[model samples]
Target: MRPSRGLLLFLLANLLLIGLLLHSVFTLLTLLFEDCSNDAIPAIDIPAPDALEEINKLPQYIPKIIHQTWANESIPEKWQKAQKSCRDLHEDYEYMLWTNEKARNFIAKEYDWFLETYDNYPYPIMRADAIRYFILNHYGGIYIDLDDGCERRLDPLLSYHAWLRKTTPSGISNDAMGSVPNHPFFKSVLDSLQKYNRNWQIPYVTVMYNTGPLFLSVIWKEYLPTVKSEETRVRILMPAEYNDHPWSFFGVYKGSSWHRNDAKTIFWMGQHWLLVTVVVFAFCASLYVCGFYAYRRVHLRDSNYSAHASPFSSWSWPWSKNGYKPIKHEV
Candidate 1:
């Protein structure tokens, strides 16, 4: 005999419930392993002498400037104006506005091994983001985004061996990063690029995870515990200190299409992967239980029919017997 629809649904629901439970367990195990692995690695600390007293000491650091655009000629008028702001503030700094070709050439000459992955990057903005960390590692200097305008001389920021700016919602921003040549933190960032390089299928996610602010944030977190002293630690300039007012050190321009959040971004940003898994498991389990209950009810009905209809049946309903009639009246 063919199985009823309820039975089939019950089997399918059971399978779904089992899958969800397994997935939840796997996710928990993976998270645990990763936490333990991170703890196992030894922290690296670099010493910086007199770093606290050397505020506003720009001359001692590299006076080079670096920024990237699609190309020199393709730069928008507003961005060009922003670039001029940096130039006007620090005339002595060797400002270099790298175009695609120039950036490729520089990377090819200095970091040849990174070229394959760099060229294979699915997005231009990803390439733009990745090169800055490498540039700072090879030739220490200030790297700023084209959309960011300079409100004052960046000399004060150059005091530290390295610095990162804080961003909203948590974590550091990569838009404005400064470092001395071969800073250990920057080196860690470069070294981690290939390992963290992932294609998340979404453009924004891929860029952010591989080479954007998220990438930098992860490396910075790992680098933090390694700092044995205040001097060696990377100084973080809070949003208030960096750009609280219009005349703040970095005047940010909002008109940029390169980085925008989407539904996928929001979904990942929520970061409730484990919670979501648990909820799904619960829902599936409930569905399976309901289906099983329905199946069992149908099964019992069928079994009763089979038992009564059989030639050798020993049981029967009391009301189904021949000449069985109620003699009593109303109540």
Candidate 2:
């Protein structure tokens, strides 16, 4: 039996109503999450002041020795070179903090802003997920990146009240960062990351939230007092390479080192091996190409024998050795 026109019309009206209701619900949901995304700071369980103090005593902080890999690099030769570089940096800094339980917990609690997963692979985003622990766990000072080997003493950075360097056109590089316990910058930075993360779904706010130095500068400007003498020593380093030079941790792409992996681990291990491997491979290939060209040139030039020489003249060539020497016997 066919349904009545009224029944069909009623069903259509209900469907339209349902659609409208769902749209309204979705709009409300988006609005609700908007605040969370825009907010810069995430709620964290702060460690007691005494516990934080205890953590500060664990070891002397080294500006180098950011992090290490338990497994060798994918390429052995490259791994060795990177390890040597890390070691050299370690010598300069005296010590790199080892991965320990306290450190892990601190990172999990403090910097677990992103809620990203390593999925069994080490990455910077994972570190971003737990940056707080890294800062709190290590003593003396935090080492920022592994690949960035220090060429000069960071005494200038340490000699000031607080120091931050700007990179390229971007301001305030986070590649090498340092802070004492409970530094306001730390709180402000974390807060900014959390706020941006919270409002991440809002397109405009998401962009703002994901930005590192923007967040940093904003926080520093808002909170930290600027004094002429030793209060804030922020400087931007002129970039040697204009291409792919990132000024802040926020400049990293979604899957890029800053965005995807932890700051400390990526700085320490991810980059050196890749750069070394590429350099070594290029060097080896260049040698082979040059050697092959030289060998071909020498071999061809030394091939003084002419294969197409006439039979009558084969024996009479003046430069001919035994193989092609002209026969003195008259035929």
Candidate 3:
């Protein structure tokens, strides 16, 4: 049996919704989970706790410069200890604290071309997020957040041409990064800073998708596919070698001082993402159903109009006001 018109309409509406949902999911996965399977810095290559001493004496690829940033010269009481931990652990390494004035001055002096973009960032945190990339590209060194303290010597990480720490679920974090000066990956990141620079309106989202970790992750994902040689490849620093293990290089402390109220909503949604997804799907389905019914109502109302009173009603013989009549003479 043939399906009714209403049934066909329902099927079509559902098909459209399904296609839309699939497209959204594909785009999200493409951005958030790209390159998760490979490119991770393997454990075997990392210097174990027992080998930290031997590795420190060996020559390293990255410069012995540790970069950290803040609003001014005076570090806050809360993060001062964490900041000191890195210095105490790496006594021989040079430490550069990028204050607000210093950062803007450096940008203006060395990279005047980016001064406009650097100045126009909607959030101060965006500037902080951006300068780290530029600093890494200009000078080969490890950039770590003030909140992240060094637990072990970072000489092991210096061996990689360029490296970024991986975060939970998917994607990489910019909290800690190391690279040789002018590495292709860092150069790509430098080139991409302005392109990804757009005000998303929301404080948290604008910072993240524009100049924060998400931006870095997206650039890393895109940059990997174009890399033809091992030297140009950006290595992934997995959690185990980062902060998950006792032998991990760094320890995380409380951070996110720049987060606004919107960040809480975002964090809540992340915690209850499955429920949010289900509700969103349900709402879309409900809209489709309601729209289909409204269409059906309009169609039926038009078709069931009074034929005798309406001049533009369906074509019919004069004798048949109801839109049909028998032809007696020609039978």
Task: Point out the worst 10-residue segment of candidate 1 by lDDT.
Answer: 38-47
Ranking by TM-score: 3, 1, 2
Using lDDT, give the best candidate's number.
3
Off by over 4 Å in 3: 1-27, 31-37, 52-59, 292-331
Better of 2 and 3 by lDDT: 3
lDDT of each: 0.68, 0.40, 0.82
lDDT of 3 by residue, 52-86 (tens): 57676766889999999999999998898889999
lDDT of 3: 0.82
Best by TM-score: 3
Candidate 2 stretches greater than 4 Å from native: 1-83, 89-94, 97-103, 108-126, 129-142, 199-208, 224-331
User: What C-alpha RMSD separates each model from the true structure?
Assistant: 10.9, 26.4, 7.6
Tens digits of per-residue lDDT for model 2, 146-251: 3343332333333223344444222334545555545445555555554444434433333323444434444544453542433333322223211133211212
Question: Which residue pairs come into collision in candidate 1?
Answer: none
Candidate 1 lDDT tens digits, 74-97: 778778788788888778887777
Residue pairs of candidate 3 with colliding backbone atoms: none
